[model samples]
Target: MGVLGQPINFGVSMLDDKRQEEERLQVLKGYEILDTPPDGAFDRITALAARFFQVPIATVSLVDEDRIWFKSRFGLSATEVERAPGLCASAIFSDKAYVVKNAIDDPRSLANPLVVGALGLRFYAAVPLVTHDGHRLGTMNVIDFEPRDFNAENEAALVEFAGLVIDQMEVRLAAHKAIGSLTTLIKTVPELGIDEVATVCAWTKKILIDGVWYSFDEFLSQKLGLTITHSIHPDAAKGF
Candidate 1:
């Protein structure tokens, strides 16, 4: 997580490993996220931050192991960047806000391509998006072409906006997870409905048993005791 160790001109996986690609994909999937379209809430936050700080570009970035991907970007639609030594990378490593008043004067960021390259970014400030579970997700930040100080007011506003961005991410993931669970159940039994209490009970028991098992679905289909036709009521069979 330290910025010093990360690469300078990265293409993809910084660490070379035979299994790292699979591991990387797993890491991306663990969040149950990847290749998703941009969300309005995230984009709005970036755009508003750009206007508020008067920066030409603003972004909500997620730092993967080797690259930086933009969840939402303003004044730009870049997909990824090398996880090179940059102000944002340093901020993520330190788990604190990075404020580079003047990129040319700041030795730490002076050599960063974003500052020296065609983008010509000068003033940079970013607040780290540390998750509630303590994961260093990435940063919410804005960049401007001018060298200027962000007063206390501006800095505080940036941090507050960063928090909102994080909140939106958390909410989005929660909703996605809820929808996935519901979908799984519906696939298991197509007639799933609130009034169908008996089916719900059966599904619940089967899912519970599946949790302790490696091949839960196969076991459930064989032993869940769900009949294709419910003509013989469970209660009637037991004389309950």
Candidate 2:
């Protein structure tokens, strides 16, 4: 019976943790962004960041409830990973910035899948993409195969680059939210419930906004690498 009482306290703590997580996640989701098919603008940015730092990989990653999704990537991959296994998860721990100079050498990254897995990435530096209102959307990261160090100048440069990434994310959030409201204007305004209707409504918002400008793919291209061209087929052109 005493142990049963202990469970009550544990339950309260769990609820507190869950509430905290939900609030944080709401802030993350409030950006009303992340995870769509693709876009040219986004691709360009990630590629440029990778090349600028001379790293083999770069990503604009969003830490979702269960997974860290890649909005853009330059050198290596686009697949999602479990949130518990993400190094960028640590970035959300602080208000500033985070870096992992050598993945294999550091205790944090020694077991990170992005390091030991197929990509063979040994180095990482993550700059959080933060909103002006202080919402942390995700990270702008540069990954490399060799163990190395960045001078003060380089760190400064990466920080600046990360700022640009945040700029894009802010715009994306605005665009997505607007689209979502407009679509649901035909229905009802969506709130926090995870009902299927709400999810679909959110997606509808995504499609409308994406088509208006660049798709998510185009945004990622510019963010990842400069080489991505946002040209569309003559018939497919919708004036975004």
Taking every candidate in turn, the Cα RMSD to the unseen true structure, in Å, is: 13.2, 14.0
TM-scores for all candidates: the values are 0.67, 0.63
Estimate every model's Cα lDDT from 0 to 1: 0.64, 0.60
Q: After superposition, how far is residue 186 of candidate 2 from its true place, in Å?
A: 11
Model 2 over residues 33-136: C-alpha lDDT tens digits?
Answer: 55676656678888888888888777777777776777787864435555553566566554555677887889977766556665566777777776565556
Model 2, C-alpha of 239: deviation from truth (Å): 29
- lDDT (Cα, 0-100) at 5 in candidate 2: 21
Candidate 2: worst-modelled 10 consecutive residues by lDDT = 6-15
Q: Residues 206-233, candidate 1: write the lDDT tens digits.
A: 3323234212344335544443332533
User: What's the CA error at residue 120 for candidate 1, in Å?
Assistant: 1.7
Local lDDT at 118 for model 1: 66
Off by over 4 Å in 2: 1-17, 176-240
Runs of candidate 1 with Cα error greater than 4 angstroms are 1-28, 193-240
